[model samples]
Target: MASVKSKAGANNESSPYRESARAGAGSPSLVAGAASLSLNSSRAYALEDFDTIATVGTGTFGRVFLVRDKKSRGFFALKAMKIPDVIRLKQEQHVHNEKEVLTEVNHPFLIKLFWTHHDERFLYMLMDYVPGGELFSYLRSRGRFSNGTGLFYTSEIVCAIEYLHARNIVYRDLKPENILLDHDGHIRLTDFGFAKKLSDRTWTLCGTPEYLAPEVIQSKGHGRAVDWWALGVLIFEMLAGYPPFFDDNPFGIYQKILAGKLEFPRHLDFYVKDLIKKFLVIDRARRLGNMKNGADDVKRHRWFKTVDWDAVPMRRLKPPIVPKVSHEGDTSNFDVYPEDEWKKEPPVPPKDLEIFKNF
Candidate 1:
């Protein structure tokens, strides 16, 4: 059976993607750097410029569609978010931050945001349409990955994380659901809604419950240390077929994170176990990537000893799971949605259009 893609931000008990407290503005200290990385394209695009192929995924504000450009006939993923829903959900700043961070960064593993535009009713982002679907679907189908396969996927993610940390950008969300595989099976990190460029700490209580770090759970003004913790959880899930911390509710999950106890399966290699232990430390300062040597220490770890740093970003290494994508716009890996899901809601004019002037 083909694996089905999960809903984007449905209100599930464990769905931390739909929850956030106060929305804050980015710090002024990083304004110049953010501006330098701004993406402004001269081409003018409209909603009618593309023909919708399918509703690939849904989010808190709107839906992601697989589309084909009328002029070039090229396939692209058009992310259209309802303006009124975004305003109602208090996600204005997060939308802006996603565009800001995506515009400025360029890495092999990160998704590319081609351009952005907004109308009175919706905000649209044009991006590369990765043919392969979510890594979550693939992981579910396989149950668990082998040590070699898990190492391959996690190594690619480590490179992406290192690049983000170098720029002082914190990718707070790093789960299988947020990662998409390209046709060649290389991972493309998506969903920058929770990502931020921070010079210090941010107090926002957000992110998936199973992946949240101890500092975030305690509301201790978290920074990039949270991502390292998530990475450790990701590594464990990839090998063990489940997260290190699981519970019947979010509160229960937090308790396990605070307790910081890990029970590794006996089959895990000694070096791999040590790597996970260093990453899951409750103290951020003691975390592997947060230490003095920085991400260098993580790359030098025993588990990643065989990784060729030079070849990782270059796509030289062979991928373990090359998706069987037939053409530019293949939706077989994604689940099918109702054809009129986006048409059900009538468009309502946004009252505060000034806030989205830059969009």
Candidate 2:
């Protein structure tokens, strides 16, 4: 999850999932705002409260650990980010946005942040431990999903996306890597580095190249419309086994996206194609979710006609891929990494202390 900062059109390989092309110059008000947000639960936590179990995920600024709470013996995903790396990478605002948004929203399909704590060297976010690993791993294992399976998963994501938009938050990062399967196999959206609340539009160049919208690539001020565009890319990847636009590099991928050429596999039906097309439209205003009806327009599309809206959020719908977890701390669903890297603490500079004062 290391962030790669490069000029536009450069090939960024740091993340096989989402990559941050440009980092914000840091936001003081935003950081202060995030610091003031109250914890979701009454229980306050710190690094010593949990015993580290395994390394479930890693990124540019930090790594996610599967940790067990000492008091309750409960399992949780602990996201530990190095404060110096956060400042050096210019991801302070994003780190704050993630905390603020997670602190504010509660959705069945979205990952939950229990509490946040910061010591001199690192920022820690305690969240629910999703035993099921990234949806990307499963998709690769299966090659691709059947129409029924794809529809079921996409429907759940639709519910999650709708929930965020209703609260005026745009989930700018939407990809298979960010989607995690719960023990029951339902989707739990993760990673809020690119998510932000928008009254109008934001002109930050972020997100994965394959899923980036044309508006985002052009640096046009974008709002929630970008989420719909990524949804289209997500649907395409789910159904076709790959994104519609592809190239060896990010620039080429952007070209294909701007060209707006979509070639579906012979297996995709007309209804599914129509749904993706509407979501992938180059014009933001004419896009399905950006239309007058908003997310209802997406929910009402013909491709999702079979979905039970009420059941989707209630988690009544069975997930297609139930991860084989042995116990509460079972991490068989996630990939293993060298544990030593997490032990080597990075040096923290004193100059950056005020930036994370609230943390």
- The number of clashing residue pairs in each candidate reads 0, 3
Mind giving the per-residue lDDT tens digits that candidate 1 earns over 118-168?
A: 655566666778878878888889998889989999899999999999999
Model 2, residue 290: what's the lDDT? 93
Off by over 4 Å in 1: 1-42, 341-350
For each candidate in turn, the TM-score is 0.88, 0.90
The predictions' CA RMSDs to the true structure, in order, are 6.7, 5.0
Q: Pick the candidate with the highest lDDT.
A: 2
Local distance difference test scores for all models: 0.74, 0.75
Error of 2 at 11 (Å): 9.0
Worst 10 residues of 1 by lDDT: 26-35
Instruction: Write down the worst ten-residue block by lDDT for model 2.
Output: 24-33
Best by TM-score: 2
How well does candidate 1 score on lDDT at residue 170? 98
lDDT of 2 by residue, 142-254 (tens): 99999988998999999999999999999887888888888889988887777898888988888879988999899888899999999999999999999899998788899
Q: Look at candidate 2 and give me any clashing residue pairs.
A: 1-59, 1-60, 2-60
